[model samples]
Target chain A: MAQRIDVKDLDIYYGDFLAVEGVTMTIEPRSVTAFIGPSGCGKSTFLRTLNRMHEVIPGTRVEGSVEMEGVDLYGPGVDPVAVRRQIGMVFQRPNPFPTMSIEENVLAGVKLVNKRISKSDAADLVESSLRGSNLWEEVKDRLDKPGAGLSGGQQQRLCIARAIAIKPQVLLMDEPCSALDPISTLAIEDLIAELKQDYTIVIVTHNMQQAARVSDRTAFFNIAGTGKPGKLIEMDDTSTMFSSPTEKATEDYISGRFG
Target chain B: MSTTAPPTGKARSRSASGRAGDRGMNRIFRLVSTWSGALILATLAAVAIFLVLEAWPAISLGGEELGEQISWFPEDTSIITFVGPLIFGTLLAAFLALILATPLAVGVALFISHYAPRRLAQALGYLVDLLAAIPSVVYGLWGILAFAPIVYPVWNGIAETLGWFPLFEGPAADPPRVMATVAVVLAVMILPIITAVCREVFLQTPKLHEEAALALGATRWELVKTAVLPFARSGIISGAMLGLGRALGETMAVLMILSPGFLYSFAIFQAGQQQTIAANIAAQQPEAPPLGVSALIATGLALFVITMAVNMAARAVVARRKDFSGAN
Candidate 1:
């Protein structure tokens, strides 16, 4: 089941340096929200903060509250491991534990909880999750094969399968399609459209057309200069953000003027 | 040299030139490279030929001159001994060192690569490198004068508490200078070589793979278990082998730590009683007859075979684990 996120006055920092400042927004449940910005504007950094993964890096911390279903993720006693389990993430590159097989990768997240599911149930879980990712028919026979042997798009979908296997409340995708070919990118885009009906999905993309095509709502991020922290310039319905963005920066960025 | 020149061939060659000068240097490097490659096989062949020529007396001098016993004093006795015990001693001591060093080296490597803070890790790394630089004779002196005395109580305690075991069942003498001491000292000596290689390998675990593990809700240690360690297995084995190589061929350190014993005693706790091939050759080579020298060389040939076998086995381990290791 999907859950809504309420982030209030979030400031992301790597050591003493402010990366993204005062990013306050609510991401609705069962919808696709795209965070778009140029390089160094901290879109990916902000995305990582949502899942409490930003703090994994040494000396990196966040101020302000990221709430998932009324519970603050950064609040005291909230384990980052638990936060990650509840909210799954797919990285830019389709890194399917290079040591694992295709089936093992699908089982990776669930196995992290240290629960012992029955063999039949695990096989079923693998089948259903692979089916959900639209990869079961193609890979059902060779589940024992190494995951890295798959093509780029297939690997991305395998990653999606791996993430969704956890059945997280929210799925945070950070430029998941950038390294993929156009056809694979389209497959992921279509998969995202279907996935949003069940799970709250947030994606970070530099591709404006991708933001327009895949997201229900688009949040544009910007920075003043190199040393400045990135800020959310605007958030609007996908159509409106592309057609008539209120902020000059958002419009210019959308119009290919400047980052 | 900086020169602004738009020039003909003569001016181009004679100018203060990086590009033109590099061409002659490249040819020189090519010639040097050819010789370097050739020298490797040439050196191996030369060593093998020399060893064969020197050991011919022991190999051919049948009936009591050789092929009788493993004793070094060949001139005094009519029956000289084969090098079976010396071969056994060298391998056992090296193996003993390996088993002792592996866990400690891996722990130190893990601490440096994963656990320690950046500054502390750097400092520890430098200290370990310094540990590796201490001369063998210095280690021998320190082991006998300082280290052995310090370690006596602990060794005696282990011998008493677990003395029922064959390895510890022997006499636990004061300032124990047995094969076990040689092994323990070799472990300390090889620690840096193993740790340094493993630390580098652990650091080479891909950031993407590490992040992948973390994103899967793995704790720091679990991340290491799933990602860092599986990735580092080959390097660790190879590092262990490097340490093992040094332990096998070690002369001065083992020579000082172990006391002389000609018998095949299985007990490790007995002090002042062991002779590895290297220590035997180092100690007795000066006073030995031609047959004695040839016998030593033959023993050296056996050690050469043992080291080769150990290396081959290490290569096999690295190759065998490739599927699960993710190094391919």
Candidate 2:
């Protein structure tokens, strides 16, 4: 089930230095929202704070709130671990556990949380998740093979299957196709379009054309200078953001004049 | 375009030097490196030959040239009888040390690599590494004078209560100088080594994989179990085997803590019953006659073989899961 996310006045900091400041947005359920920005613009940093994955790095602190379905994710006594169970993530690179088989990699989210499943249920879940990622036919015969034996695109799909196996309400992808070939990138883009039908999706991409192609809502982030904190320049429907109304900086960035 | 002759001339001269009788610095570098690698193999082969040659007399004579049983030498017994108990004691003490130290070392390693605060972790790592720098003789003295007395009462209590177990059988040594004491000392001796290797491997685990586990709602312990431990399994095995090798060859600590005897007894709590090969060689070699010295050399050869076999076994274990190896 997809869930709406409300982020209010969130300031992300690494120690005393604020990396992202004064950001506010509401992400709609069952839709694709993309964050497009240049290097060091803090779009990825903001995405990490949504699931509190940024806290994994020492000295990182978040001010303000990220609420999902009316529950404050960072509320007192709320465990980050539990927050993550409801929100999954796919990284810039595919990272299936090298020690696990294809079937086990698909079942990693459920198995790693120490849940018990019957043999038949495990088999069913593996099949459904792999088919959901469009990887079932390619790997069904080799379920016992190591996940690392897959090609780059297949490995990335395997990671997606792993993330969704736990049935999270939201999925955050940070440049999921950045490391793939053009053909693999198209496969992932198509999969992303299909995934939005069932899960609220947030993606950060360096490719402007990618944001225009797949996202329903587009948010542009920008920085003033090398050492300045990043800020959200504008947020609008993808067509309007690309075609007409936007801040001057967003227009220049979209036109490829400068980052 | 202007022609630049200096760059081309320099290359020609370099190739010319290679073809000339001088053979150039590149050839010299290759020769030096090749010889360095060859020297290591040459030295190992030489040592093996020496051990086999020196141990021949003991092997050929058997019990024909037996003399009175020296307290430490047991020269009166046949070579088989003398060395059999020594092999058992060596394996028992080293493996006991491995069982005692491996988990503790791995925990300390994980704490330093993943659990400790960033600033404190560096200092903690340095302290653990410092433990390895201490001399084996110092550990021997510590085991004998300080630690043994402290644990003597516990040893006696275990023997009094759980003496039915073969390992704890009998009246515990009053001074607590026994194989168990030797094992404890050896465990401490090897702890730093295993911790250092394991910590290095744990630190080198891919950050991407760790984040993947965390994003799946895995707790810190769960992340370590799923991501860190499996990746470091081979490295842990290698580290433990390295520690076992040290424990097996450790002479000074075993000699000081284990009162020397040549009996095959499984009762590790008792004194004057068990003796390891290295310690036996160290204790009895000085007083032995020619044939007795050969017997001691044979035991040393056995120790060498056991260590090699252990290293081979470790490699096999590491290679068994080739498809799942993190090296990919």
Best candidate according to lDDT: 2
What is the lDDT, from 0 to 100, of the residue A91 in candidate 2?
96
Model 2, residue A67: distance off in Å is: 0.8
Error of 1 at B131 (Å): 0.7
Interface RMSD of 2: 6.6
Clash count, one per candidate: 5, 0
TM per candidate comes to: 0.90, 0.94
Pairs with steric clashes in candidate 2: none
Please, what are the lDDT tens digits per residue for candidate 1 over residues A107-205? 988887756988998999999898888899989999988787788789889988988998999999999998888999998999999999999999999
Q: Which candidate is the best by TM-score?
A: 2
Chain A TM-score for predicted structure 1: 0.98
Instruction: Give residue B22's error in model 1 in angstroms.
Output: 7.3
Those runs of model 2 whose alpha carbons end farther than 4 Å from true positions after fitting are B1-29, B68-76
The per-model DockQ list reads: 0.40, 0.49
